[model samples]
Target: MKRIAILGSSGGNLYNLGGKEPLKLLGEIETQASSAGIKIAAIQFIGAKASMDNANESTLSRLYTWNSSEENIVFSEEKALKEVNGEAKKVDSIIAKMIEDGKVQGLVLMSSDPEGVNNLSIKAAAKKDIPIVGTGGTSMATIQSMGGKVIATSGTTGTTNRTRAVAAIQSLSRHWGLKYKPVISSSGKSSQNLDENIFQRISFRGIMMAAIPGFIAMSIVLALSKIPGLAKLNDAFDLLIKGLPVVVAAIAANQVSGLDEVGIVAGVVAGMLSIDGGLIGGLIGGILAGILAFYLIQLALRWNFPGTTANIVAGGLSGLISGLIVFFLISPIALSLGNGIRYIIELALNYNSIVAGAIAGLLIWPAIIGGVYHAAILPIVLLEMEKTGASFLGAIDMTGLVMVSAGITLANIIYPKQKSESAIAVPGFLINIAFGTFVEASYPFMFSDRLIFIGAILSAALSGVFVGIFNVKGTAYVPSVTAPALSNNALGFTISMIIALVSSFLITLFANKISRNKRNKEA
Candidate 1:
C-alpha cells in the first residue's frame, strides 16, 4: 500500500476555492481506489480546518463535521500551516517523517488555488518524484501542468454527486483492471448528476455493429435451413453457424460492461433478427412507438395531464412499445422467414459485385461496432455480411450512412431552435430525416450554421456516388469515420468521408452567416 498525503486548502488566500471540494474529491478518490484493490496506509488532512474556517463559517462547519466523522483521515494542522508560510521545509520534514516510517507513498494536493499552498506541495512532491492526483481543486487546464494524472467527470450541479459516484466506480474499475490498486483516500459522497443522454450517439453506434450480425446468423440457422444450396456452401454455412455464436457472446459482454439492461435486450433481438422481420420491425416499432407516445401524450394533455407526469408516461410508453414490437413481432417473423433477407443479399452478392461488397461491409464493421456503440442495429449488419462476404458495395453503404448521420447530429445541436416547433429552430427535422435514414444519429451537426451542414451532406452524397462509380467494397464495415483504417479501399472511404465532413462544415458556416446577415439587414 502506497501512502497518500491529502493536503487540504490553506487559510486566507485560496481557502474559499477548495475548502469543501477537497473533502468531496478525496472521499471519492479513496473509495474508488480502495474498491479497485488499493490499500491506504495513512491519510493526512493538511490544513483542512484552517482552510475551511477561513472560508464562510458554514463551509468550515461542514468540513469540521466531515473530518471528525471519517476514521481513515488523520487531521494535521501543522504541515498545512507551515506549507502556507515560506517554511515549506517544516512541511517537507513531516512528509519525510511519514516516508521514513514507510507510511507515505504519494501525495494528493486538493487546493483550488494551485498557486498558493498547492504550488508549494507540488514543488516538494516533484523534487521527491512522488506521484500526485488532482481533483476538484485543480482546473482542467492546469491539472496536467504539473505532470500528474487528473481525472475529471462532467455533470450539472444537481447531478454532480451521482456523476462523482459513477466516476469513482469507473476509475476504480480501471485502476483495478490495470493492477494499480495501492492507496486511496476520499471526501464525502454526494448525489447530484446529469442524464446519460450525452453519450447516446456513441452508444448507438457500438450496439448496431455487433448484435445485428449475430441476430442474422441466428435467424438463418434457427428458422430458415430450407434455402437451396445453403447447406452446400461451406463458407456461408460456417459463417451462419460460427459467426452467430461469436456475435452473440460479444453482445452479451458489451451489455454487461455498459450495465445497460435495456440496451442488452434491444441489441440481442436486433442482432438475432435483421431480415424477415427484425430490421424493419425495430425501425417501424421505434417510429410507431415515438408517434404513439407523442399522440397519446397530446391527447392526455387535453384532459389536463400534468406536464412532468405526461412526459414521463409518454417516454416510458414509447420505449416499452418499441421493445415489445421488436421482441414479439419482429423476432419470430425474422425466424420464420427462412433467410429471405439473406437470399436477397445473396442475389445481390452474386450478381452485382459492388452491391455484394457493400452488404458485406454492413455485416462486418458497422454491425459489430454499432452493437458496441448503439446495440440496436446489430441484426441488419450481421445478416447482410453473412450473405455478402465483404463486398465493396457494403463498404460504401456503411461509410455513407456514418457520414450522413454524423453531419445531421452535429447540425441539430448547433441549430436546435431553428428546427424546433417555434421560431428560430434551424432545420432539425429536415437534416435528421436525411441523415438518420441513411446513417446513424451522428451526422446532422456537420453544418450547424447552415452552409457547412448542407455542404457536408452534399459531399457525402457525392462520396456515395463515387462509391457507386468505383465499386469500392469491403468484407468489413467502415469501423470509423477515418478512411485510412477502412477494411478495403480504405483510402477511398477515408477520402470520401473527409470530403463530406469538410464540405459540410464549410457550407453550413456560409449559409448560417448569410442567414444571420440578412436578418440583421431586415432589422
Candidate 2:
C-alpha cells in the first residue's frame, strides 16, 4: 500500500474560507484514500498557538480520537511562536526522519498561511524525491515554485480550501489507478472549470503518462520473449509494439476528457480508425474525440438530460464523428507528413551524417529547456521508430541529452563550488547514470552557471558527431550504460557517450575554477 503523511496547520482555515466542516472534509479524504489503496501513515499539526487555539473544536476532538484509537495514524502536534517563523522546522524534522525510515512515500500539505509553513518541509521532501500534493493557496504555490514531483490540486488563487482538499484526494486517487468520482459540492457545481482552454486541457504530462505504460509493457515483453522458453511470446510482443498507437490514444483521450468514460470510448474508436496514420494520427484523433465528447457531455448536462442518456449521446456521436474524420480526412495528411519528414532526415543522413548529428545535438538542449521538445520533436522520433524500428535521432538523444547530463552532474560532484552543492550532485549523477531518464537532474548546476550550460551543449554536439560518423542508431530513453548494446554499432555508441561525458566534465571543471577565482576577486 502507498503511504503518506499529512502536514499542515489546524482546520480553522477550512471552515473559515470554504464553509466546510473539518471532520466532513477529512472523512471524504479518508474514503478516497481507502479506495486508492493508500494509508494515512502520519499526520503532523503545525501552527502558532493562536491558530491552534482557534481551531474547530470538532476537528480537534476527532484528531484526539484518532490518535487514541487508530494504530495506523501517528499523530504529533507542534506549537510555534506567535510570529510563525519556526513553524515548519519541527514538522520538517519529523518528516525527514520518517522519510529516512522509509515510512513515508508521499506528502499532503494544507496551509493557508504563507508564513506559517515555510519551505523547510518542502525542501526536505524534495531532496528525498517524495511526491507532494498540496492544497490551499500558499501550499500549492510553494510546491509549484520548488518544482520536483509536486501536484497542486487547484490554481494558487481563486479556489476554496475545501475544494482544493477534495481535489487533492481525487488527484491522488486517480494517480494511483483508482476510479473515484469527483466530489461535487452541495451547490451542484464541479471544481473543474469547463471553459478552460482546449490547449491547456491537453496536458503534455498526461501525454507522457499515456506513453510510459506502453513503453514499459513493450520493454518487458520484448526482454522476456528473448528467453528460450518464452519464444512464443514474440508474437505477443510484436502485437504490443504495433498497438502502441491505440494505447497512447486511449490514455491521452482519457486525460483530455477529464477521465470521462465516454471520452475514453471515443478515443479507442478514433485510435482504431486512425491506425493507418500511425502514432501521430492516433494522438490527434484522440485529442479531437475527447474534446468533442467533453463538450457534448457538458451540453447534454446543461440541457438537463438524464446521465445515462447524456453518456450514450456523447459517446455514440463522438465515436462516429471522430473515427470517420480521422479515417477520411486526417489519416492521409498525417501519413504524408510523417513520410515527408522521414525523407528529409534520411536525405540529411546520406548527405552528411556528422553535420546532421551536430545540428540536432546542438539544438536539442534548447528545445528541452524551452519545453518544446515534447510537442515538436517527440512526434518525429515516434514516427521514425514506427516506420524503421530504429532512429538516428534517438541515438543523438541518448548521447547528447542523457550522457551529457551524466557528465555535467558528475563534474559538479568532482569540482563543486560548495559542499552542499556536491551533496546534491551525488544523487543527481547517480540517478542520471542509473535510470538515464531524468535529465532535469543537472538543472541545478546548469541554471546556476552559464558556462556549464554552454559546455553541455557543445559537448553534446561533439558527441553527436561521433555517433553520426560511425552510423550508430538504436532505441532511446533507456539507461545510457545499456544503450550501446542496443545500438547498430555498439563500439560507436560507447565512444559517443564517452566523448559526451569527458568533454562536459573537463569543461565544467574549468568553469568552476574560473567562477571561484571571480568570487575570490570580488571578496
Candidate 3:
C-alpha cells in the first residue's frame, strides 16, 4: 500500500501522545495510505505530551520534527522558541532513528522553522527524495509561499477561506469517496470582523463614508449566525424591519402632500388614543398607521374598488383618521419625550444600528410574503429613541416620512401600468404590507426577480442619500407621513422615496411581464 511517514515536532515535552496529537499522526498515516496501497503499519514517533487540550504543549508540538524509518517529518518551530536551537536538534535525532528503522516510506513536515528541528528535518527528508507535505499557521499565505499542499481547520483565524475549504471538502467527500479533515482549529465561527477596539477607533468620517456598514455587518452576521440563536437574531429579515417605517414612510409621504400631515396626525392620535401609545407616541403612530392603511386597502379592494380609486381612498382615509388621533393624544407624550428634533436625536443615538439593520433585513422577506407593508421597521426605530435619548425618535420620524414619500412616488409610476389589470397579489401592495409586518417577505420577491430588486435598492440608496444630504428631522419617536411639515429640506427625502417605490413597482411589473412572456413562449 501507499506508505509515507510524517515527522511531527511539537512544543510539548516528548512524553505521552494521545487524543488530538494522534489525529495529526492519523493525518500523516492517511497521506501514507494514499501513497501506498496499504494500511499504516506503524506510528514510530509523535509528540507524546502535545496536549491539544492545552496551548503550551500544542504550541511546542507544532514546532519540532520526528522521524519514522529514515523519513524526517517537520513541524514549524514556534517563534518564541527560535532561540533554543540545541534542544531542537535532540528532537531531530529522534526523528532520524525512526526513519533509519524503515518504518515509513516518505517523510512529511508540518511547517518551516528555519533554525530549529523543523529545518533539520526538511534537510533530511530532501536528501532521501521523500515526498514532503508541509503547511504553516497561516495556511493560505504560507502554502502559497511554500508551494506545498495545505489544509487548515475550519473556524480558524482566516475564517472565510477556511469555511470555503471545509464546504468544498465536505462536498467533495460526499460526492466522492474522499475524506478530508482539518488540522488546525479555532472556535467554530465562520468569520469575524475587526476587534471592538479597532472598530471603535475609526473616524466619524470613515463611518459615514462606509455608509453601508450594513453591507459588511450583515455579511459577517450571516457568516457567524449559522447556529440557531445567533442566526435568527442576525437574520436579514429582522434587520429590515428595524428601520422599515422610517425608510418606507420617507418614501410614501410625498405621494400626496396631505399624507405626511396625515401620518403625523395619525402618530399623534394613536399615541393619545391608547395608553401605551401615549407613553411612546412615535412608535404607536407607526404601528397604528400601518394597521390602518392595511385594513383600509383590504376593505376597498374587497368592495370592488378600482385600483387608483382604492389607493386614493385608502391613503387619504387612513392618514386622516390616524392623524386626528395622533394630534390630540400622542402630541402630549411626544412633548415630554422631546420638544423637537434635537431631543429625539440626542436620546436615540445610542441604539444599535447593526442590530437594527439585521432586524430590517430579516423582516423584509416575510412582510412581502404576508402582504404587510413597510410598518415592520417602525417599532425598532421607535425603541431606538429610548436607547439614544428622545431626539432619535424625531430623526426616525423624519426619515420615515421621507421614505413614505418615496414609496408613494414609486407606487404612482408602477400602479398606473398595472392599474387596469388586477393581479392575484399586487407586487407593491405585497411589498408595502410585508415591510410593515413581516419584512423578510421582501427577499423572495426580490430574489425571484433580481432585475426588479436591483432597481429598488438603487432607488432606496438614492433616497438614503437625500436623507443624508437634507439632514431631515421630525418631532416624534417614529416616522410620520407629515415629515414635510417638520423639516426644512424634506422634499429631497420625499422625492427619493418616490423614486425608489416607482422603480421597485415598475421593475416588478416588468419582470412579471417578461416571465409570463417566456412561459407562454415555452408553452
Candidate 4:
C-alpha cells in the first residue's frame, strides 16, 4: 500500500488561532486515507509539551514527536520559540529519513508559519520527489513556490483548515490513482478546480543549481592547470567538462521525479547516451526518462508488485527506451540545433560586433527575467566554453548585465531620495561587485521607476558596444571583480566594465534626481 506522513506544528498558530483539536485533525486525515486506500505510516508533531501530549494521545500508529521539552512534559510557549531551530532540524532529518527508506510516498503538512519547520520539511520532500499537500498559514504558498500543487482556501478558521487539508489529501490521492471522492468547499465548488499553477513543475531553478557546481569546478581547474604540477589535471578536467551533460541530466531527473531511484537511474542512462547531443539533449532525455519511470512506478504500485521488482523493471525499461530514443532520434537533431545556434551567433559577431553586442545586451535583461537564460542561453554559453575555452557572450553578460546592475545600485546609494532605500541597496551593490551574483538588487529600483529600467538596459547596450569593439571574452558566471582577469583581453574587459558602470550610474543618478524633484513637488 502507498504510505504517507503527516507533519504539523502543535500548539502553534494553527491551534492557537483556530482553537482546533489536533486529535480531530488526525482523525480526519485517517478517515480520508482509509477511503483513498493510502496508509498513514507516520505522524510527526513539532512544538513543545502540547505536541508530546498530542503524540501520546494519538491513537494512530507510529506517532513521533519533536518537542522542545527535555525532562518535563509541560508545554511552554517561550521554550518552543527558543528551540524553533532545533525542532526544524529534527523535522527535516526525520522526513529525509522517511523518504530515504521509502517509508512514505507522500506528505501532508499543516502549519501557520511559512518558515522554520514547514520550509525545512517542504525542502526535504522536494529533494526526494515526494508529493506534498499542505494547508493553513503559508503552507500552500510555500509548497507552490517549490513548484508543488495546492488547493486554495478562503479562510483560516478550523473548518476551513480541515476542509482545505482534506481536499488537498483527496487531490493527492486522486493523483496516485486511488479511489478518491472529490472534496467540495462550502461554496459548492470542487476543490480540484481551486488548484493554482504558480510555478512550472519542471523546475529550472533546480537545473541551474545542479549546473553551477560543474561550472565552478571547470573554472577552478582551468585556473589551476597553469601551475606546473597541475598540467595532467587538464585532461581530467576536460573529461569532466564533457560529462557535464550527464551531471545536468541526473539532477534534472531527480528534480522531476523527486529523487526516485528508478527515475534517477534511467536519467543517468539517457544522459550517457545523449553525450553527443550536449547539455540540451541530456536535459530532454533526463526529463523523458523521469516521466516514463514515474508512471511505470505508479503502475507497479497499483499492481501491488514488490518494490525491488518494480524498481528494476521501471529503471531498466525506462533507461533502455530513453537512451535508445535519445541516441538514435534526438541526439543528431540536438547537435545540429546547437551547432546552428553557435554558427549564427558567430556570424552575427563577425558581421558587426557593435550591433551584435548591443542586441545581446538589450535582450539579456528580459531573457534573465523570463526564465529563458537558464533554459536557452546557459547551454549555449557552456557549449561555447567547451569548444573555445571562453565565451564572448559571457563577457557581455558580466560587463553589460552584471556591471550595469551594480552601477545602478551604486547610483541609488550616492543620490538617495530616501536613506532607507539607499541602505538596502548597499548590500546588493556589494554582493554584485564582490561576487557577481544576484542582479535582483537593482530590480526594486528598476521596478520603481520606468526611466531607470530603460536607462539600465540602454546603458548595458552602450557598454556592450565597448566590449564588442575590444573583443572581450571570458568565463561566464564568476565573480565580476575577478572576471576581468579571466578574459582574453583583461585590460579591455576592465575598460568595458568601467564604461558599463559609469554610464548606468550616471543614468540612474539622473532618474533619481527627477524622481526626487517630482516627489518634492507633490509634497
- Candidate whose lDDT is highest: 4
lDDT of 3 by residue, 1-523 (tens): 3344443333222122212354434443443233223333333233424332354422443333334454344455443333334455666665555455554444433323434444444444445444443323432243334443222212121112222222223322323344433222222221222111222322322222222222223323433455456657444634543333233232222211112233333333333333332224433344455446445544554454433344444455665565456557665765465334434433433354333322333333344346442233333333333222222223333233223323433443444224332341345344443332222324444555666555445444444444444443333212234334333344753553454455555656666677667877998
> Candidate 2 or 3, higher lDDT?
2
Model 3 ranges with Cα > 4 A deviation: 1-380, 383-444, 474-481, 486-489
Worst 10 residues of 3 by lDDT: 153-162
lDDT of 2 by residue, 497-517 (tens): 899999989998898889888
Give per-model TM-scores. Answer: 0.31, 0.61, 0.25, 0.63
Runs off by more than 4 Å, candidate 2: 1-191, 203-209, 216-234, 302-305, 517-523
lDDT of 2: 0.66
lDDT of 1 by residue, 1-523 (tens): 4445555443333344333454554565456455444545434333444544353432322221123244454432333343334333344455546655556555544343345434554455555655544334333235457654443322112122212333333433443353432122224422211122212323334434545545434433432333465554545555555345324432432232231222333333333333234333444343334344434444443344433334344445544655566566665664444268656645665576454443343343334334442343334445454434343434444445555444444544464325451222234333433332334343334324445444544555565555544555442232343223323455665665555445544455455557667877998
lDDT of 1: 0.42
- Tens-place lDDT digits, model 4, residues 1-523: 8887777654444554332455445545655565566766666645434432253432222223423234111222334333554544566667667777787788776663346555555566666777776555455676767765443322233232334344556557667877654221322123222112111446665675567767656666766666689799789778876787787777776556532445567788878988888777887778777666656655654454433445665666776778778889999898788688778888888999889888888888888878887777776776666554567778877887888899999998999768888998899898888887778899999888898899888988887888789877775567787787666677888998999899989999999899889999999
Let me know the TM-score candidate 3 reaches against the reference structure: 0.25
User: What lDDT does each candidate get?
Assistant: 0.42, 0.66, 0.38, 0.67
- Which stretches in model 4 have alpha-carbon errors above 4 Å? 1-200, 203-209, 227-229, 369-375, 517-523
**Candidate 1 lDDT for residue 191:** 22
